[model samples]
Target: MRLRLLVALMGVGAALLCAMPAASYAQSCEMKLGAMGPMSGGAAQWGLAMKSAAELAAAEVNAQGGVKIDGKQCKVVVVPYDSKYTADGAAAGSNALAAEDIHLIIGPVGSPEATGIKPVAARNGQLAWNAAYAKNSLEPKFPLMFHIAPGPAVWADAVIKRAEKEFPMKSVALIAPNDQGGTDIVSVDAEAYKANGIKTSEEYYQRGTTDFAPIVTRILASNPDVVDTASSPPGDAGVIIKQLRLAGFKGPIGRLGGPGTAEILRVAGGLDVVKNFYWFETVPTEDPKVQEIDSLYKKLLGKDPVGGTAVWADLPAARMTLKAVSLAGTDNAKAVAAELRKMPVDDPNIGKGYWTGKKQFGIAQELSFPFGIGIIKDGKNLGVERQPARPD
Candidate 1:
């Protein structure tokens, strides 16, 4: 009777040992994803949006028992870095994250950061998505680099035409920081305006200059029918618009760059102060599906997402990257990039988009989503109108 009892106890111990491996395997597997952007400074909203998007995407995957890789589930961990909206900052951020064995990055929002991160990220075998309007936002040489959205070239003409219908303009002055971030977008904007039969003049200032009184005087001297804060950070644009109004310039203000209308309104003192305005919105923010993103973020992250529409625009890139990682069965940058190129550009919240940029960037790595043209006539918001995605 004693021998039989001992044998039964041994069999029970063996079964317990067999169950331990499955639990251990689940706990051991993890994937580290890097989120880089300017977490501070004037463009902080854009950067913060990128980080929030990455976090939300990770949370969604974690909810489903994490992402499947190599026949095991791996929990995705997002490591965020503040790249300071500068080229050097982004380059350093890439190397820093690479040291931690992170192979994918979701951010570095500005034009300078995009220019800064490409070569460094490539050398580190990292795949990075940038939401910059830089001329070189995507290039054939940087296979690992992808664009979050198309630059002004894709939608500038459509926006300009739409704005003309509401606010007629014969001449316009464009103001932005005197950097690649400003020049690349401003130059393209100028061409689009000219193409629409409007006269265009360009003005640029040092990025950190707070007092735009001098710049406002110069812009008003041009006596433009409309003044455009093309590609300026939302903070800088607000101050510029406030000064423009104070200096006795009463013309429609336009933004051909990024979206930050809510921030701009608060900074510029409100709708009454902004008066007539028109701009390019990266997404049709009024859509019920798009509005649901905030609720989803709150539910998953247990917090509100910052950066407004910018966060919604950045979410798809982060989600698709994780999907690619699962499809590749590894976090290897090259393998994941291969999968990304093959996958369709689709997002549940943002709906359908296209993979474009073959003609402009010589590579089809840019995500072209349905964008919107926003208008505010005489201090009352007229809302954003959805535009179809252009064919690649």
Candidate 2:
């Protein structure tokens, strides 16, 4: 029964994504925005998506004769770099961009990479609109570093609280990559799960791992009722699930951040094998306001919006940065970052509120964007459906 549901979800996710039209590009303009992410590594898809979205957004703004900052129409332009999923690479890319005389930075998609380049952003007096999740990564504080989403700690806590009520499993197992980002999130999950009186088992694997028989055997032996996977992109998660099924393990699995049903289905061959897997999905369903933004995105890019948690960050960060720059009446990153502290965002994803309270990096920079849960159900080889993630 569970397998059947997963197959159904796979189909749904694919249809929605494929339904999107190719992006129609708008006319180019002058204001340049530097964007960075892992463009040429195991996580390149993430960077590609970010690049595509940022470019599309910039084109849209540029088409309107650019953003009117202090009465001057500066056309939006985006410069992007591939961090190659490495901290060193990310830092180099950031410094290289800082030397280019640009004002704002968009990414460095993975958390570890984000940590590597954050200091560079601070030293050069630039704003880093982080697009990755690293629990406690932004703490002890660096100036000019702004996080748009809740960290992995928040996600771990959410999963624990939900699991306690929903699954009511006696023991849960966790599998995460040994990378800095994954380890950090696992730590968070362990702490939160233990605090909730949840028995836990854990195993760590290197990134780029495709075979999961050994891990699956270990997990089954541990006899965990629930498994939490802190992997991204959905592809790796798919591999893990398929191997689990092949190993004859029958337990629920949760994945973080992979809703592209096609990716999972293609790798798993069938949704039945992956029916028990779930992911923390962040995109909200069709809302009137989001639809309006989607229309605007389509109009400018000639493509439907590929909704993701990043869009919330990209759109609002762009807006905040632009507004601050306009209000400060200067292009200095320091001044603009300062002015951004006074700005308030009322987007549906970020919730209706202002960032007037605490500062992430000292008297400026606060969090935006809300985190939500999602589960995968009814999946096919190239299609999937994601319902809002509920407890358990």
All candidates: TM-score: 0.93, 0.78
Residue ranges of candidate 2 with Cα displaced over 4 Å: 1-29, 68-71, 163-166, 256-266, 286-288, 291-295, 304-309, 348-364, 377-392
Compared with the true structure, what per-residue lDDT tens digits does model 1 show for residues 302-378? Answer: 89999889999999999999999989999999999999999998899888989999989999999988888999999
lDDT of 2 by residue, 103-215 (tens): 68777667778878888778877777665666534543566777554444445566555544434666678777777767766676677778777787778887777777788
**Top TM-score hit:** 1
Question: What lDDT does each candidate get?
Answer: 0.91, 0.62
Could you tell me how far off, in angstroms, the CA of residue 129 lies in candidate 2 after the best superposition? Answer: 1.6
Local error of candidate 1 at residue 268 (angstroms): 0.5
**Consecutive 10-residue window with the lowest summed lDDT within model 2:** 383-392
